[model samples]
Target: MSGIPGANRQAPKPDAEGAGSAALGPRPATLARYLTIYAALWKNSVTREMMFKGNFLLWIVVELLWFALQLSFIGVIYLHTNRIGTWTQWQVVLLIGASHFIQQIYQAFFLINCTNLSELVRNGKLDFLLLLPVNTRFVVSLRQVDLGAFLNAATAIAVMAYAARQLHLVLTAGHVLTFLALCLVGVWIHYSLMFLLATTSFWTIRAQGIVWGYYNLFQIARLPDEAFRGVFRAVFTFALPMLLVSNVPVRVLADKLDSSRLPLLLVGMGVACGLVSEWVWRLSLRHYTSASS
Candidate 1:
């Protein structure tokens, strides 16, 4: 339960006599206002997730195992050849850690509801979203927020920082800004991919295999894009390309991408992917002949 705007507590809706007029502010008049609903809805979601506190602890355990595996992956690769690719051990570690950080933003900030959205569409709960006062896209994408995954994100920064220090990397404003830009693009690309996957539910009732397989692609996110060469890189570089979004951010720090130089090209790719994803989402909406009245 959420508080009536003027009510003293967080419980939903109060009597007019106790909480003043029942009428709340008119529907959000601007995009910014409607976007705020994401935050409000997220707060409610946080409460819901917290109610199952055991699951939160289990998530933390899973996150620990996840981080350990990625780190150990880099370790094993280094032992085999001292460097499986051009990157030194530290560079590879930084890439792995940075990938985790980026992955967290996607999972925590955007992918939560979108990934599971197919269920709502299949079950007919989606019709209710269409009738809500908020923007349907916003409502659908942010129906919930998962904060448990954020622990992985938080731990990842520490890993990234340690790796950066080992490599003698120093941070600069230009690097930071370029990284932020790439991160935004990366988040969008990630969400867009998930959105496109969820949209399949509009036509099909089951897509669990499709969703799981797509997510498994993130395992490749920790590697430098250049490690993929020849036809493999060509295929991944554009078609189903996780490389452009993940490795691009790592390169921002490694300076494979010169911030002083072609910053526009890197971000342009992100924007392009995001736009295509949004277009696909809208197209899916057009096909949504609701399962329920």
Candidate 2:
């Protein structure tokens, strides 16, 4: 008799064994591994988008047309009045451009990822992600990129540049850097809130409608914060903070910040939203029942 159990049994084939071993290899450290994985994901996204050239081109055209329509609306509004609650025509244009920039960047990088969480939960595809040898949250939140949305984001930059010229706003290195930083903070705020909405799918099984309804609040970001008042203003400003996303950054760039504390307040709101979203995500995961169960 063999000394070891199964010593005389036929060995598994080398090809199968090697493949299994490779799949089970030790996972790398978080930051480096995450960077590598995200790069790969972005490359795969670009390749997949390129495979459907017509669809990609059509989406780009649609986004550009929508942007033009917004500009036209702004022009019509300005034709009637010199200013809308302290925002001149060009300032409102800048605000809308900033709003578009933040929204497009969120859509390009995080919107699909957040929205897909619901589908994965509904169909039990999340099990595949959970079984992977990497962080599930990172993988789930950044699996794809929308290249057409990124192209639209570039158009937003052009709009902002034109608005700045119309307002004769001098752009300094510091101002540009501050604007970009605030824009990213705005994007992060949107991502956190949207992800929180999607995370509810663990309980609801389908949260796409709720996720999109939350997205509609972003339209209010394009308007001047000063235009709102009383109860309605308090709800969005303090509770939701949707009004602050584009408004603060535009105020920073336009030298229209009413208080020195507005930027600080916006940053605090973004941090709070991110922390709350992460907590909700962890809690929601605890409630998830795998499809097999």
Candidate 3:
């Protein structure tokens, strides 16, 4: 809105020199314009990342080590017992891999942007971003991309492949596609919840602790949902829905759908979370007091 000039004015009369080109070329649609903007943002991010190749590579190694620690924790549990709540070792590995993949995808695309919301608000940097000629939420939620996090997600995929082999799971094209799709659903659930937490910055001085706290909650996602009991299970599976994220997709691959309705429930939860996050973001914008004001 701020970039567009003379919204009420008619199209300007073209000079004879460029009249033919102006008449033949149509204006880009709104969605197309936004897509182009997002592409440019990604390009800039990639360019900046190239300038810090060492840092990028270092982060990838650190994440891989972190993932190894998680797998080691699972291995320790398996040494004591073969299964945790009806899930075999390989099945649990697959679930943890799915959780890691979802978490990385969310981190790569959205986490840094959402986390920056608080800093933007604190320093009044958000005022300029809000004035950009695009949806405020879109600008805030997708201005940065972390290639390291995205590349690190490949480790999870490799682990999942090994687990699938151990479980003797059939890997049909349809099955693989469904698994990936469900993983994306898991990512959406994370993005929505994290975005909601980040929006708390509109009221508080800083909400990074709250947002990072939510990141720590992903540990629960890697565990078997059945291991949780009573109110704890109920709250995570439905209220927060964190347990459903990786568990649902892993169950589908392992042919362990306890209820035929689990998939439907997971999809419904993703949609509900997305809608709630959007509504809350718009509401929070109204409360934002720019630095100048």
lDDT by residue for model 1 over 48-145, one digit each (tens)? 98899998889878987988898997788788776656678888888887778888878876676776778888778877776654446666776777
Q: What lDDT is reached at residue 61 by model 3?
A: 93
Candidate 1: lDDT over CA atoms? 0.70
Clashes of each: 0, 0, 0
Can you list the residue pairs that collide in candidate 2?
A: none
Error of 3 at 262 (Å): 0.8
Query: Model 2: per-residue lDDT, tens digit, 1-293?
Result: 11111112211222344335434655343344556877899899989999999999998999899889988999998889999888899999999999999999989988888888999998898888876655466678879889899889999999999999999998899888999988988898888889989999988976999998986798888889999999989988777888899999999999997676988988998888877877787788777788866
Give the Å error, residue 169, model 2.
0.7
Inter-residue clash pairs, candidate 1: none
* Model 2 alpha-carbon drift over 4 Å, by segment: 1-29
For model 2, the run of ten residues with the poorest summed lDDT: 1-10
The lDDT for every candidate, in the order shown, is: 0.70, 0.82, 0.82
Candidate 3 local lDDT, 192-277, one digit each (tens) = 88999999999997799998999778999998998989999999988789889999989888999867698888889988887788
Could you tell me how far off, in angstroms, the CA of residue 103 lies in candidate 3 after the best superposition? 0.6
